[model samples]
Target: MVKHLIDEQINLNLLTPEKTLFTGEVSMVVIPAEEGELGVLPKHAPFATTLRAGEVKIYHNDNVSDVFTISGGFAEIVNNKCEIVADGILL
Candidate 1:
């Protein structure tokens, strides 16, 4: 199958003590970094930042997405992969 830009994904891994929230690919993600809102995509430059209590938007497609309220955490991106070890998360 062919992939559209919205379907052009990057690897993602989200973890918490209770369980692994997500592990796979996503089109894009918006994180609430402490400095400001961060928009991440595939092949993005290596990034690491602190997060604040806010919304985390995981975009799956043009018309589909998942949002979560994060209490706090750290986000890091490297080699087309994004990992988030959340302090606390609310679906």
Candidate 2:
């Protein structure tokens, strides 16, 4: 059996006690950072960083996509997986 790769998009609410904003597969993701925007792709290195209030771009395939704004939060990357825990999210 072959182990398939699974890509996931994670969103959360910081204000709420426990709220899952969004979770699914995405072609690409752009995270807003203090320095600027950061792009994430498959097999990305393990990383952890803080996010600023700004637009988060979610790319599905080539033409399909969506954008959301996050107040603030933390993001972690490990094992080719990306996880984002945010305060507030708006799309």
Highest-lDDT candidate: 1
Worst 10 residues of 1 by lDDT: 1-10
Steric collisions counted per model? 0, 2
Q: Model 2: what TM-score?
A: 0.74
Error of 2 at 55 (Å): 0.8
Task: Estimate the Cα RMSD of every predicted model relative to the unseen true structure.
Answer: 3.2, 5.5
**Compared with the true structure, what per-residue lDDT tens digits does model 1 show for residues 1-91?**
1255565788988776677877889888888999989988777899999889888888776543677788889999999999988888865
**Predicted structure 2: lDDT:** 0.66
lDDT of 2 by residue, 18-91 (tens): 67655776656788876788887666777789989898777664443667788877777676566777777755
Compared with the true structure, all predictions reach lDDT values of 0.82, 0.66
Error of 2 at 14 (Å): 10
- Alpha-carbon lDDT of model 1: 0.82
